[model samples]
Target: MMIGPTNLSLTLEQLTGTDAGSVDEAPTNMVRDLIGAWKTPLDQLTGREIGLLISQQDGYPYVLDLVWPMLEDDPLLEAEFYPGDILSSLMRADDTTWRDRPNYKRRLKALYERALRRPDDETEALRESLEP
Candidate 1:
């Protein structure tokens, strides 16, 4: 079957064993486990898949922490993933205002800035100096 955002969300819910509607109420350990389970190989994902994953309101923190780092390693994938599109999707995902989510704008801005940073082929030792 073709995978879309809802399909991806359902997969995540199944893998993590946390209902999407109740993700916020899930325990810290469960959330941590979900983070680990959500860490799919960046190379295996399509741009649209990546977009859908990050667009998920319930999955935002996991996507930010786990997925953004992977994007840094691949110039093509990083360039193809648009922060604006994700931001728009996030806004539309819920009726709540952006200001209500304390870290949403900060995290989004950070991701946008990271996207603008130069993509490099470097060792872990040299990676720190390359970050914006």
Candidate 2:
């Protein structure tokens, strides 16, 4: 049976180690290119823009580690982000139907929800030991 094109790309990317490790040199270069392409004047950008840039370049998730502490008492933002959320979503992708999962705008939203629901008992039980 023939797999679909989406599966084909996913298979190729997995074989090439794209999903298994840190963003390789090529993806790093591509992110850099996207940043340059999206050169909105600094004055025009918002927190989301900053978060996205840091996320792409660092391969970090939800921009939480990068932006959380600096956000003051903004529960709105904190409630919106969590460490490992984005990364987990990327890692959980089904090899065949990633694109059809949802539109890009809500991808992070779904990821955050899923991450929040993961077993947190072990995490909550060991705060100091878990600090990284």
Candidate 3:
């Protein structure tokens, strides 16, 4: 299902065990509010939660644009898992319609490059994550 900000807020509340409210705020606003309420490092969230955020059907693009960047430097966000999952998901979503979304391609390319630069041990996992 398409998960917009309100849905995302609910999901975050469920996952993080905090009440971030169900207001239909913009994705960025909801992210900000959730972060504030979470009070913990974003990377403290498990890989599964990060995967859910990246794989959301509706606001995935916005989540990538806004939230992903924030989590990029989080030590808890494993490079092999998080970036690989995001890159794989982005590539899977890139269809004929993706051509019109230059920003998406740029972000996808950037993530791919970042994944490639991971350490040898992590790179293996990244490669495996991308494989069909």
Query: Which candidate would rank higher by lDDT, 2 or 3?
Result: 3
- Residue-by-residue lDDT tens digits, candidate 1, 1-132: 212222333345454456444435547754543444355443444555556565545454434444444444542233234334543344345443233444544465454455446444422222432345
> Residue 112, candidate 2: how far off, in angstroms?
16
Candidate structures ordered by TM-score, highest first: 3, 1, 2
The best candidate by lDDT is 3
lDDT of 1 at 29: 57
Candidate 3 segments whose C-alpha is farther than 4 A from its true place: 1-47, 71-83, 96-101
Query: 11-37 in candidate 2: lDDT tens per residue?
Result: 222323344333334367656433432
Deviation from native of the Cα of residue 130 in model 1, angstroms: 25
Which window of ten consecutive residues has the lowest lDDT sum in model 1?
A: 1-10
Please provide TM-scores, in order, for all candidate models, with all chains considered together. 0.33, 0.23, 0.46
Pairs in steric clash, model 2:
none
Where does candidate 1 stray beyond 4 Å? Answer: 1-11, 19-45, 74-111, 114-132
Model 1 CA lDDT for position 79: 20
Q: For each candidate in the order shown, give its overall lDDT on alpha carbons.
A: 0.43, 0.36, 0.49
RMSD after Cα superposition, model 1: 13.8
Model 2: residues with Cα > 4 Å off, grouped in runs: 1-33, 36-38, 58-70, 73-132
Candidate 3 C-alpha lDDT tens digits along 21-51? 4445536764654444344234354455455
